[model samples]
Target: MAKPKKISTLNQSIWPYLSPRHWPTWFGVGIAWLLAHLPWKLQRFLGKQVGRLIHKVSARRRNICLTNLQLCYPTMTQNEREQLTKKHFESMGMGFFEMLISWFFPVEHTAPRVTFSGEALLKETFEQGKGCVIIGGHFSSIDLCGGQMTRFVKVHPIYKLQSNPVLNWIMERQRERTFEKTIERSNMREVVKTLKDNCAVWYAVDQDYGRKASVFAPFFGVNCATIAHIGKVSRITDAPVLLYDYYRTETGYHISLQATPDGFPYLDDVENAVAMNKMMEKLINSKKEQYFWTHRRFKTQINEGDKDPY
Candidate 1:
């Protein structure tokens, strides 16, 4: 039989990726491809199992998660926090599968499985002829739901470029295929340009970026460094910034576009940061384990000499 012709993108040849050093990455990708083909329930089961393995092996990861939980859930007993830490790792493993599924799964089959609870709000905002800035947090299933969102409305996601060339190519290509466009996380200019054309841009503000372009705000129960760019962008472009919440349901994946509290884009930077934190906390409160808790969220302190949490 004749050999099938190989396919490659116009920008680059597959020969480059086939190099020996890239083989390990390709092998890992191949494993992920196989996992992507598994039944949904089975994939999740295996994902949880992988999470369990990581939880048992990575004490540093466990400690980070535990510390975050300790700061946020002060009322929970140590035993409860420990249990939540394990569950959070399992959630992280599931997040890995969710990302793969977003990239590799059949969109025709998977897109329908997503349910946008506040789709009407999404439509209503677009009708006003204003661009939308979606403010979201570091949820486990963010990419999973964000990919599905394209089926309903065009959404340009803000992403940080990955360091690994092969991995970066794979992710960028997949995101290009899934979203209207993938704007670099640092490229606020491009983000504004896309919005100026009356489009949607998704951004996250929950992580600690230290004091620069940030203010100390109460996240959960602890005051941490928080970015207030969401408000500035909204003010710059006259865009309506809405809260985006993502999670899973028994029937399918779920997402919401909640209207930001009135008087957003406040002139006071601290006010904007406080409101952003409150909104994000409300979203994460719905599902504790679904949020990315292993991050060193409290790494930055309001006072210069305060002890670090992690």
Candidate 2:
């Protein structure tokens, strides 16, 4: 692996005053900080409990997850789908602790738990001097997996703005500790500029963003809204796009990196979006229980007659 670059630090002076609405955010952060100091095994155990509790109480999110599973795995029996949903919640529960570990602990402490494969692909792509875009689906262990990647390579991560300013401030501070930079999800100008400068940018391409600024594409055999900007950005920057995915094993975490199909995004925007969804499907299928299914992936419809799955 190439030597990791020095992380550029950002000012962390945006602490907001505690208000009624902000109390939950602050309390959550406080609890996470305390949990970060616990042993990994214990933390994982606690996370499983938390996740199980959430699955019982969070009806709306639970329904969304089950709806997604039903759509994507129509052949599976209801019993099988329900079991998968329960496992997914357990994985998500563990992910909460993983995020705390990623944010509060030093990279040296967490590095031993994660193993990497196919890194040569990333190194070769970086060596080409056109820059690289590392894309992945939204998995439960995403935050900690990205933290592990930062130990080996300098990366700028694209992030959606959090609605809670205090929470976002703290989250960005944690990310700045590892990533070369954190780019706002909507800042395409910076994304292009970073790639043009031969820097790697990490993007998670799976989610529902409504009808506008999306292309109707096949995801899990159903037409769903998919982002079409990746092809346009790749065309602008001429950067090689790579697929990276991480999953939890019985022992620890495993991360894999591979180059995308040759001449990808050479096709039109809709084709590119279709290709992106196909790639995501391949990875998500490998660890179906770890994929983020709480959000409605099939929220947007191609026609007015199509009903909302959520």
Cα-based TM-score, every candidate: 0.92, 0.92
Q: After superposition, how far is residue 153 of candidate 2 from its true place, in Å?
A: 2.3
Candidate 2 lDDT over 163-270, as tens digits, reads: 557766777788878787889787898998899889988888889777777988899998998987888788888888888889988778998888788888765988
Which residue pairs collide in model 1, if any?
A: none
The per-prediction CA RMSD against the true structure, in angstroms, equals: 5.9, 6.1
Candidate 2 matches the true fold with a TM-score of 0.92
User: In model 1, how many backbone clashes occur?
Assistant: 0
Ten contiguous residues minimizing lDDT sum, candidate 1: 2-11
Residue pairs with backbone atoms closer than 3 Å in model 2 (clashes): none
User: Per-residue lDDT of 22-117 in model 1, one digit per residue for the tens?
Assistant: 899999999989888898888788889999999999999889999999899899999999988888888889888888988786456677777777
